[model samples]
Target: MAGTLQFDLVSPERRLASVVASEVQIPGADGDLTAMEGHAPTITTLRPGVLKVVSTEGAKSYVVTGGFAEISATSVSVLAERAVPVEELNATLMDQLIADASEATAVAVDKDAADKAMADLVAMRAAAGF
Candidate 1:
């Protein structure tokens, strides 16, 4: 098998990452999917969770809110709703965000709106590991 695959991670704001990695684990719709060089071409929807990339240097993790991943034989591209490096995550900020989302959801008159807010808050908390 080949040693590495080219990887790109993009968000609505900008391209968050571009690198070559030996392996990557993504939060797929069904579950976590691991990819490596020479993998078959496919596309998968991603959930809000941690994406782990492994290289000769080491493993790095990123928090992805939502997106789709395109996997080719030699490349993988992820277009995310929101993408952030794990190193940049702040527990305090996440806590505040969760509280705000919760408060808004609690007073929301529309059930669907409240559900979406709750889901968003849960996803953010999950991605942040809080």
Candidate 2:
């Protein structure tokens, strides 16, 4: 078996996950990356996408709007602006998320990031069909 690392994900609402995982797939602002045991220490901003955690127990996924990930050799910590388990996402929930993003985009001073985030949320909704 591959080496494991501690992984934790949290948002303002609650703590979503705390587990030991073989790997974690992150949706980085620049691109996608994977973190694993013995990985180099780094931090990156997260984009809107599914965050997948593969562990001894099984695979779990969460939808994150925006966030920061701190990856160290021993652990990966994610602090998200908003997050929801993939299983809990539905059309109603997705609609609200998109609407919220839209509102935020309209008022944002920096259009680049808001535009990118809005685009990603749309893509995520399309990909998930919700």
Candidate 3:
């Protein structure tokens, strides 16, 4: 595992994934970034998008609503606000998510909240290939 890093994706409910991975794609608040073994240590806030994990076992993708990631030379830990495995995603679920986001956006009390909700909707749509 010299070229691999421990990656863990945790949500409020439970841990979603814990494995050794070659690379992980994260949706940083500023942008997307990829983490690999020997990467510089850093912390980043996450945006709503897909988190892709690549390892010897193959690739797996997860849809994250928002979160934070702590990256280190040998580990990447993701604390997600909400996450769902891509395998469980479907057009119907995507539509529901979009609709729920739209409602949240409409009810947002402030411009920042509204913007965030809108962005989440956009990201969810993109991830769902809508």
Candidate 4:
């Protein structure tokens, strides 16, 4: 743990990942950023994209819709609106997500909200390589 940092990824439903990692790549709202053990303290909003975690166990990836991340010298914590392990995602799931997003967009109360939802889904699809 000498060169590693504690990283936690939490969705509204549960904690997705909590482990010591050498590096974490987050899809920040403004852009993507990587955090290491000695990184400076910072906070950022997330966009729809993939999050990469690198540890002794090797690398794992998750797809996040939106969230906020708090970074410190010793840890990085993410509170995600929606997060799913990339390995668990499949074409069927992606199609379902897209359909759901389309429905939500169609029934959205406002244009801005609909746009955001659609954009998030689109990003998710692209990230999933579909």
- Ranking 1 against 4 by TM-score, winner: 4
- Summarize candidate 4's per-residue lDDT along 1-130 as a digit string, tens digits: 5689999999988889999999999988767899998899999987666889999889999877667999999999999878889888988877776676577567656667567656766777776687
Q: Give the per-residue Cα lDDT of candidate 4 at 11.
A: 96
Scored by lDDT, model 4 comes in at: 0.84
- Candidate 2, residues 1-130, lDDT tens digits: the string is 5699999999999999999999999988878899999999999999777899999889999989878999999899999989999999999999888888898789877788788888888998998887
lDDT tens readout by residue for model 3, 1-130: 4599999999998899999999999988777899999999999987667899998889999987777999999999999988889888888877776666567567656667557656766766775686
Model 4, residue 80: distance off in Å is: 0.5
Report the Cα RMSD per candidate: 5.1, 1.7, 3.1, 3.6
Question: lDDT by residue for model 1 over 19-112, one digit each (tens)?
Answer: 8899989987656799998899989987556788887668888877667999998989999877778787788766664565567557766667
Top TM-score prediction, candidate number: 2
Give the distance in Å from residue 112's predicted Cα in candidate 1 to where it truly belongs: 15
- Stretches of candidate 2 off by over 4 Å are 107-113
TM-score of 1: 0.72
Error of 3 at 118 (Å): 3.7
Worst 10 residues of 4 by lDDT: 108-117
Off by over 4 Å in 3: 99-130
What TM-score would you give candidate 4 relative to the actual structure? 0.77
lDDT of 1 at 4: 88
lDDT of each: 0.77, 0.91, 0.84, 0.84
Error of 4 at 79 (Å): 0.5
lDDT score of residue 16 within candidate 4: 95
Better of 2 and 3 by TM-score: 2
